[model samples]
Target: MKSELQVFQDYIRGRELRRTPERERILQEVFEIHGHFDVDGLYLQLRQKGVKVSKASIYRALPLFIDCGLVREVDFSEGHWHYEHIYGHSHHNHLRCLGCGDIREFENPALDHLEEQLAREYGYHIKGHHLQVEGYCPGCRQAGAFPAESNFLAKDSNDQ
Candidate 1:
């Protein structure tokens, strides 16, 4: 398997874009992170490492990374987007805690079967899919982490 930097270099060359040290540094930092992260968190990490990368550079590089299949965007309904590097990883889904903002990664063979069934039934070419299941985690529920007002279902349900 090619290293992230090599893959990125190939991608940059293929696109006729210049490969800069800043982009390489950004890629290094991105892969160093093991979990979900937003731009602000990424910027802070880079700064702490004494890398002089700007947020604008990060913003511009993100799309390129996504295009090259090195990264993917994940939304936890946190208003801003979070990103995770997907290179060298198998597909998985997320279970997120609405109360404490915790995330757990899981894989199910049933989803693969369902995807295949759907493709066969609909006659559609399937590429990929993302799933994020959200609810209060066990600890959050036990601790009563967030108030009812934070629960959109409680606020919006007619049954309430």
Candidate 2:
């Protein structure tokens, strides 16, 4: 399989934009991270690498990359958005912690089966799905670190 960077390079080559150095740097950064990152984070990293591109350039390139099916936007439920590369990899859901903002990736065959069953029962053909589960992590729960009480949903009422 072609790497994400190769895929992105081919995409830009076919687009109106040629393979400029700035575009190459942006695509490289996106491929290196391979995880959810806000534009600011990506900009800082690019700057550190001596890429003098402006934040606006990074922002503009991101949408174009997404439109070209190079990257994907992921919302992990922390009121913050992130992006990840989508180089034709297998699909998986995310498990995010509301306490420490940690994101864990998981693939559950049982959940996939359940979704298929539900879709069939509803007389609908399953096309795609995105599942994100947010909760306190094990350490957070053990420490009784609830998420601002407003969003706490611990089964143990006395957890707090």
Best by TM-score: 1
Give the poorly placed runs of model 1, Cα more than 4 Å off.
146-160
RMSD (CA, Å), each prediction: 3.7, 3.4
Pairs of residues at least 3 apart in sequence or in different chains that clash in candidate 1: none
True-vs-predicted CA distance for residue 159, candidate 1, Å: 16
C-alpha displacement of 54 in model 1, angstroms? 0.7
- Runs in model 2 deviating more than 4 A are 13-19, 118-125, 147-154, 157-160
- Residue lDDT tens for model 1, 1-160: 9999999999999999998999999999999999989999999999998999899999999999999999999998999999999999999999999888899999999999999999999998999899999877889878988666665655634456
Residue 13 of model 1 has an lDDT of 99
